[model samples]
Target: MMVQTGLPPMMAKVLVYLFTSDTEGLTAAELIQRLRVSPASISKAVGYLERLGLIRREREGRRRERYIVLDDIWYRTWSVSARSIQLGAGTAQDGVSVPAPPGSTSPISA
Candidate 1:
């Protein structure tokens, strides 16, 4: 399902495994062992997911870096995105309230 949304298949598969597991988190080394793939693949996938805020990386008992997906993951993403959009909208409104530049034909000019 995630693969269809521009995610690499390997990444999606790794995520599926994490989602299905009853465990709280999985380390990259553990993922590599279970997925039977090279460490690079898991590293690449985990990096991408972390950047997108879909997952978080943390130390698990000082042994390894664990990837975790909190239950409120979606809510966090949505709230951050909504706040960004709100900021953009506020900037737009400010632009609208400003007088147009001299001799300008910009859309913000009324």
Candidate 2:
């Protein structure tokens, strides 16, 4: 379901796990262990989620970074998706209309 929203499969999985979990956050090792994915996969997924504003990375005194979902995870996700849709719609509305390809019955001619 989340994959349909432009999130990669791994990223979607990681994000969903973090958002649904009761714990404050999970370290990459823990995520890897729980998700059964490679270390690099978790790293990439978390980085992508963080950049999308869907999750955050926190550090303990001398411990590994943990990834946690923001308090308003759903709202943040919705907002990002809405903004993307808005940008796409604006671009579409601003697009130049091209002449219909030599077909005689088409009404799409610019």
Looking at model 2, the pairs that clash are: none
lDDT of 2: 0.86
lDDT tens digits by residue: candidate 1, 15-56: 777777778888888899999999999999998777767788
Q: TM-scores for all candidates? A: 0.62, 0.83
Give one digit per residue, the lDDT tens place, for model 2 in 1-110. 99986888999999888877789988898899999999999989998988988888899769789888988888998999999999998877665344446765543555
- For every candidate in turn, the CA RMSD to the true structure comes to 4.9, 3.1
State, as a TM-score between 0 and 1, how close model 2 is to the true structure. 0.83
Best by TM-score: 2
Q: Which segments of model 2 are wrong by more than 4 Å?
A: 96-110
